[model samples]
Target: MKTPLTSFAGLDLLTSAVIVLDAEGSILFANASAENLLDSSFKSLTHLKLTDLFLNGEELIEVFHQAVAHQFADKRQDLTLERAGREALHVHSIVTALDNPDTPVLIELRENVQQLKLDREERMLDQSKANKELIRNLAHEIKNPLGGIRGAAQLLELELPERHLRELREYTQVIIKEADRLQTLVDRLLAPHRLPHIVGDVNIHEVCERVRSLIVAEFPQGLTIKRDYDLSIPEFRGDKEQLIQTVLNIAHNAAQALHERIRQGDAVLTFKSRVVRQITLAKVRYRLALDLHIIDNGPGIPPEIRNRIFYPLVSGKEGGSGLGLTLAQTFVEQHLGVIECESRPEYTDFRILIPLP
Candidate 1:
C-alpha cells in the first residue's frame, strides 16, 4: 500500500527538518527544512536512506529499528550529518514510530545550536542599531569642532612672526594635517546619514561585474576573481551606486585579508549569485530574493573580533579605519536586506540577501 504521504504535507511548514520512512526504512518524504539543511532537493532526499546522511549512523539505524520495535515509542539523540563538499552539521535528531502500518518511522532533525544562533542574531541587530546611532551623534559633534580647529591652525600659520615662521610652520602643519584627517573620518561616519537614496533599476550581475573590474584593477597579480552568477535574476529597484559601494567595500576587505595568499599566487575570490525563494529579511517575508555570496580562499577572519566586525571602528587589520564593513552593512540595510558571514581557517564567505519581485 502507498505511504500516507498526504498526511505529511503540513510538515513542510515547520522550520525543523523532518523525514518519513516506511516500515522497512525506505524514505517516503522529506520536509523543506530538511532539504535546506542537506542542501538537496526533495526528490534527491527521497532517494536516499535516512541513515545515509549521518557520518556514523549505525546507532541511528538501531534507533530506527528500536523505534519500530515499539511502535509508539520515541527517542532523541544528537547526530553529526555530513554531505559532500560541505561542512559537517551537528543536529539533534528524534525518531518516532507511528501506529500506522504504511509509514511507521519519522525522523525530526533540528540544528543543535539553532536557538542560540537566533538569540545572538536578535541581540546583534539591537546592538548594531544602538552603535549606529551613537556613531552618528558622535560624528556630528566632532565635525564642527574639527572645522574650527583647522581654521584656527590656518590663521595662526599666516600670522606667525617672520623670525619664527620656519620653526612654527612645522607645528602648524601638523595640527592642520591631523585636523583634515579627522575631518575625513567624521565625514565617512556621517556619510550614510547624509546621502539620499537614489533608487532605480538595478541588475545584480552588472553590479558584480563593476566590482570585479575594480578589484581586478586594484590587485593586478596573484589574485583571481571568479564569477558564478544566475542570469535569471531580474532587475529590481535599488540605489545602484550604494549597492556598488557595498559590494566593493566587502571585496576590497577580502583582498586585503588575502595578502599572504596573494603573494603565494593562489588567492581565489568568488562572486556567486542565485535566486532564493521563500526567504525572510529583517522580519519581513518575501517569496523570492536575490542571494549573493562573496567567498575568499584566505586566512579567515580572526575569531576574537569577528562578532563585532560590523561595529564602527572595529577592525581586524592594523591601521584599518574599520568603516568599510560598517558602511557596507548600512547600504545593504537601506535596501531592506541583510548581510552575513561565515569563516574558517581556509575559507571565508560573505552573503547578502535582498528581496526581489
Candidate 2:
C-alpha cells in the first residue's frame, strides 16, 4: 500500500520549493512549496518541463545536465523563475544529482530576499519586546527620583537667606532645570505606550500629504517634497494619527540630516507608494500589501551607529534625542506592519510595508 507519494511525504513539509526531474529534464515530482511558488497544482507541474517554469531555464538546464553527468552539485544565485500570469521570483537555485536511477536530478529554489527579510523581521520583533521592557523599567526608575529631586531643589531655593541666595540659588536653579529636562525625556520614552490604538480606514496618500506640509513648513527654503503615488491602491485600516506621525518623524529626520543639502538648495525628499503582491510580514503571507518609501538625498546615516539606530538614545546628529525612528517603528509595528532602512552616500531610503485587507 506504500506508494511513491507516501515515500516522499516529508518533502511536502519543507518551506523551500523542491522539484525532481528525470534524465530528459521532465518534471517527475513537485513538492507542496514548488506548487505554491509556481502557482500550479502538483499534477499540472509534473506534466511540464523544468525549462517551462524558469525564465533562465536554459542556464538552469545546463547546470542540471552537468550535475547529472559529473555526479556533482551546483548552485546558482539570484536566478529568476517565472510563473504563469504572476510576477517572477528571485531565488537561489541548487541542482544536485540524485543517487537514484529513476529520478536523476533535484532542484531546490529558495527565495533570496524574502527569506532574509523574514528572518530580520523575526529578530526585530524579539528585540522590540526586550527594548520595550527595558525602556519601561528604566523610565520608571528615572521618573520616581526626578520629582523628589526637583521638590528638594525648590525647597532649598526658598530657604536660602538673602546674603547667600544669589550663590545658592544658582545651584538650585541648575538642579531644577536638569530635573525638568529628565522628566521631559522620560515622558517621551513612555509616549508611544501611553497612546490609545485608534483604528480606522486610512488613505496613505493623505498621511503623506500631511507629512509633506509639515516638513516643508519647517524647512521652508531649500528642501523639495515630491510625491509618486499609485492612485489605484485601496484604503487599508490602521491608526490615521499614528501613521501620520510615523511618516512625519521619518521625513523630519531626513530633513534635519540634509543640513548641507538644504543650504545648497538641492535637498530632495520623495514619497513613493506602490502595491506589493504575495508578500510575507511577521511570518504571515499576505496576498497584497502597501509599500511606501520615504527617500532622501542626504549624506546618509553614519556607518557606526546604523545598526543600532532603532534603539533608544542612539543618534548620529549632535544633541539628537534619537527617539523619532523608534517611535515610528513602534507605531508601524502596532498596525502589523514593518519599517526597513537602507542608506548610502547621497541616497537614503526608509520603506514601510503594511498588509492590505
TM-scores of the candidates in the order shown:
0.71, 0.72
Model 1 TM-score, 2 decimals: 0.71
Q: What is the C-alpha RMSD of each candidate to the true structure, in Å?
A: 10.3, 12.3
Candidate 2, residues 1-357, lDDT tens digits: the string is 213645676899999999988888888888899888888998999888977876656778888888778657555556766656677687898888877657778899988886667768988888788888888999999999999999999999999999999988999999999999999999999999998899899999999999898887899999988899998999999999999999998999999999999999999999999999999888888999999999999999999988888888888899999888889989999989899999999999999999998
lDDT of 1 by residue, 299-351 (tens): 89998988888999999899999999989988998898888899988899999
The candidate 2 region of ten consecutive residues with least summed lDDT is 1-10
lDDT score of model 1? 0.88
